[model samples]
Target: MISELIANAVVHGSAGLDEPIFLWFEGSSECLRIEVRDSSAEPPTVRPVEPEDESGRGLWLINELALTWGHGPRDDGPGKRVWVSIAPAHMGLL
Candidate 1:
């Protein structure tokens, strides 16, 4: 899940191909959160689309499957962080 989102941000969010993208993951007993950072300050426009359309839709899937998701300013960068949180399966008992 994190891989897909990070890749999408790299491919779509950066102002240029050379711009850097960052990925972060944190986990807790009840949930897992993933953040993808890019050099663009604009928030990503994630929307639903037909599965066969074949041009967009990654973020839509992320929002659907994750428990909660959003974006915010980076701690010390000019860009923003797009994030998603998912409830840990099996209640983290495993």
Candidate 2:
């Protein structure tokens, strides 16, 4: 899940190869939250997938696996932060 979020940020968020991407993780007994921040203001979106499509399935996977997910303007800069929350039920298997 984290890898997908970071890849999406790198590919869709206009981040340069050397640009910094920040990840923050927070967890409690019942939930875990992951945030990925990159240097683009453009938000991520889910596109309709064709059966033969070989790409563009990252967001779909996140939606299917995450308890909740979203993105917004970065609190620290000009980019955006994409985040996902994993419930306790989902974390146990990890």
Each prediction's RMSD over C-alphas, in Å, is 2.5, 1.8
TM-score of every candidate relative to the true structure: 0.82, 0.90
What lDDT does the true structure give each of the candidates?
0.80, 0.90
Candidate 1 local lDDT, 1-94, one digit each (tens): 6876787777777988888898888988778888889888888777768867976777777766887888888887788899888885733545
**Backbone clashes, candidate 2:** 0
Lowest lDDT sum, 10 consecutive residues, model 2, at 85-94
Quote the positional error of residue 14 for candidate 2 in Å: 3.4
Model 2 clashing residue pairs (backbone): none
Per-residue CA lDDT of candidate 2, range 1-94, in tens?
Answer: 9999988888888567877899999999888999999999888898999999999999999998899999999989879999999996775665
